[model samples]
Target chain A: MRAVVTVMLKDGVLDPQGKAIGQALHGLGFPQVGEVRAGKVIELTLDERDPQAARVAAEQMAKKLLANSVIERFEVEIVA
Target chain B: MRAVVTVMLKDGVLDPQGKAIGQALHGLGFPQVGEVRAGKVIELTLDERDPQAARVAAEQMAKKLLANSVIERFEVEIVA
Candidate 1:
């Protein structure tokens, strides 16, 4: 099975990297861009076959290592 | 409007960061994990109201600034 886990900063957390990206986008002529937030997407190929099991495992991985509970949140999606 | 752009290293490209992540996961007892690929997800809030226009603009941003075309591939999804 294949799972995708997306880790994102919690709302109201100061994201300097995102701020920089927003500024860079504006400078690059994308004036329509307003707010920009950057996050991580980790695709994991797992031996688990069951979709529910894969999702649970991915979420466990997210909680244990992929996400910082203090400032970030994560979502896990089983793709295959 | 909200747009999501995912930037990933193309297949066969060396991804040291992803390799490191996979190793770390293995160390953390996720033996079921097989291959791990890491990518970036950028969320952009735009002034454009139309989803199609927002997607186009986001793709332009991805191509021009968000993704390193020589080694990276990008996908844009617009969600208002």
Candidate 2:
């Protein structure tokens, strides 16, 4: 099975990288661009077969290793 | 409107960060973990209201600034 974990900074956190990107976009003639937020996506190939179990395991992985709980939030989606 | 751009390394490209994460997961008792890949997601708040236009603009941003086309590919999705 495959699981995708999306880790994003929590609301109210400052994202310098995102700020830079947004500024760059504006400078590059994309004046319509507004606020930008950047995050990470991790795709995991797992031996687990069951979708429910895979989701649980992936969420655990996100919580334990992939995300910094203090400033980040993560979502896990199971895909075949 | 909001646009989401997901940029990922092309298959066959080496991803040291992902490899390290997989190793850590294995070491941390996730024996079922297999291949791992890491990517990035950028959420852009755009002034454009039309979803189609937002998608096109986001794709252009991905091509021009967000993704390295030689080693990465990007997908753009528009959300209201």
Query: DockQ of candidates 1 onward, in order?
Result: 0.94, 0.94
* Tens-digit lDDT track of model 2 for B1-80: 99999999999999999999999999888999999999999999999978988988999999999999999999998887
**CA lDDT, every prediction?**
0.93, 0.95
lDDT of 2: 0.95
Off-target runs (Cα >4 Å) in candidate 2 are none
lDDT of 1 by residue, B1-80 (tens): 99999999999999888888889899999999988889999999999989999989999999988999999999998886
Candidate 2: give the clashing pairs: none
Candidate 2 falls in which docking quality class?
high
Writing each residue's lDDT as its tens digit, candidate 2 over A1-80 gives 99999999999999999999999999999999999999999999999979999999998899889999999999998998
User: Highest lDDT: which candidate?
Assistant: 2
- TM-score of every model? 0.98, 0.99
